[model samples]
Target: MRHADVAQIVHTIAVETNTPEETVARMYADTLDSYRADARIHDYLLLFAERKVRATLRGGNSNRH
Candidate 1:
């Protein structure tokens, strides 16, 4: 994903969850890295990372898809 796309996702998630942008950005970067490690297809990495971060901030399990 582009840097601007990543930034937009971070901003959206932070606003939606009422979390700090710094916190969301960190979460996004960590989640993206984790996905990158095992990913064969790069198409949805950002989307999956965004969802995972959102789920995490909302008190959901990070282990789920």
Candidate 2:
């Protein structure tokens, strides 16, 4: 995802989860980085990272969605 897209995701998630934007962005970045490290394809990295971040913020696991 582009920086702007990721920023928007972070903002939206923060608002939706009542979490701080900084926290969401941090988690998103970390999740994306982790995924990128082992990913063979880049197409779905952003989507996966976003889902993981959301799940984590919701007190769930990355396996949620």
Candidate 3:
């Protein structure tokens, strides 16, 4: 995925999980750098996974539809 997309995911997770975006992203980046293609973080990249992201990021400002 593009770094921007990954960034969005990180931001989504941070907002939902109440963690710092930088910290969450760094954890993924560092893990990806370590595991390369073996990164488990990819699970969050799937279509359904985006639901969690969207649900978290979804405020009254935007609609998923």
Estimate the TM-score of every prediction.
Answer: 0.89, 0.90, 0.52
lDDT of 2 by residue, 1-65 (tens): 47888889999999999999999999988888999898888998889998889888889867743
- The Cα error of candidate 2 at residue 46, in Å, is 0.1
Ranking by TM-score: 2, 1, 3
Q: Model 2 misses residue 41 by how many Å?
A: 0.8
> TM-score of model 2 relative to the true fold?
0.90
Worst 10 residues of 1 by lDDT: 56-65
Error of 3 at 44 (Å): 9.4
Clashing pairs for predicted structure model 3, backbone only:
none
Q: Select the stronger candidate by TM-score from 2 and 3.
A: 2
- For residues 1-53, write the lDDT of model 1, one tens digit per residue: 67998899899999999999999999999888999999899898888898999
Task: For each candidate in the order shown, give its overall lDDT on alpha carbons.
Answer: 0.91, 0.88, 0.57
Which number leads on TM-score? Answer: 2
For all predictions, the C-alpha RMSD in Å is 1.1, 1.5, 8.5
The best-first sequence of candidates by lDDT reads: 1, 2, 3
Q: Candidate 3, which ten residues in sequence have the lowest lDDT sum?
A: 56-65
